[model samples]
Target: MKIKIVENEQQLQDAYTVRCEVFVEEQGVPEELEIDDLENEAIHFAGYDDEKPVAASRMRLVDGYGKMERICILKDYRGKSYGKELLLFMEQVAKEKGIDKSKLNAQTQAEAFYQKLGYTTISGEFMDAGIPHITMTKNL
Candidate 1:
């Protein structure tokens, strides 16, 4: 699998499709919230398997802060470290864009995943879209 920054409409669609499958369909996030206005401004990344998108994520550079969101991987592609690769790439993008810190709201179930990736939990547990979530951050 190869990971690349999405630069065209097609890749963006692939990213959205993956997100819809994982977030909207599986996680029950409202479609309205699953697809956000941030798409246009965020830097998108997709992991592809010979031209087919398998995993995806987005990074936003807002006020010199990198915020990661919409991270998803196809069910068949999970447990393969693609998520970690996507995040490392996002971190690189953040550094390249001069972002000093990166943050994300991780689903409670995935808190350990982000923690293993060097993100520190910084907020109390809260409900988001009817699911538990916690804020996490890491200095770039």
Candidate 2:
């Protein structure tokens, strides 16, 4: 898997296409919520498997932490390590930006996945976009 910062409109669209497939179509999250106003401020990332986008995420430096948001992978790619690679790539970018911490509101179902990546639950379960979630954090 090759992950790259979304640098052009087409790349950004590719990222959004994957996000829409996973978040909006499969997860029942609203389209508006999936692509929020924070997009202009966040640095977006997309992972491709031989020119086809398989994963996507965005990050913003928020209060000294890299705030990871809208992370998702296509159904066919879920079990692969591409998700991990995408996250590690994002963390590397965060580190290069002088951020030492990472934070995300992870869907409860994915909490274990994040935990395996060294993220610790920081808050109790809560609702976001009508779905259950918990805030998780990790050191970069």
Question: Of the candidates shown, which would achieve the greatest TM-score relative to the real structure?
Answer: 2
Runs in model 1 with CA error above 4 Å? none
Candidate 2 lDDT (Cα, whole model)? 0.94
| Residue-by-residue lDDT tens digits, candidate 2, 29-133 | 899998988999999999999999999999999999999998888999888888788889999999999999999999999999999999999999999989999
Residue-level lDDT of model 1, residues 62-122, one tens digit each, is: 6667999888899998898989988988898888877879999999999999999999999
**C-alpha TM-scores of all predictions:** 0.95, 0.98
Report residue 60 deviation for candidate 2 (angstroms).
0.7
Model 1 scores a C-alpha lDDT of 0.89
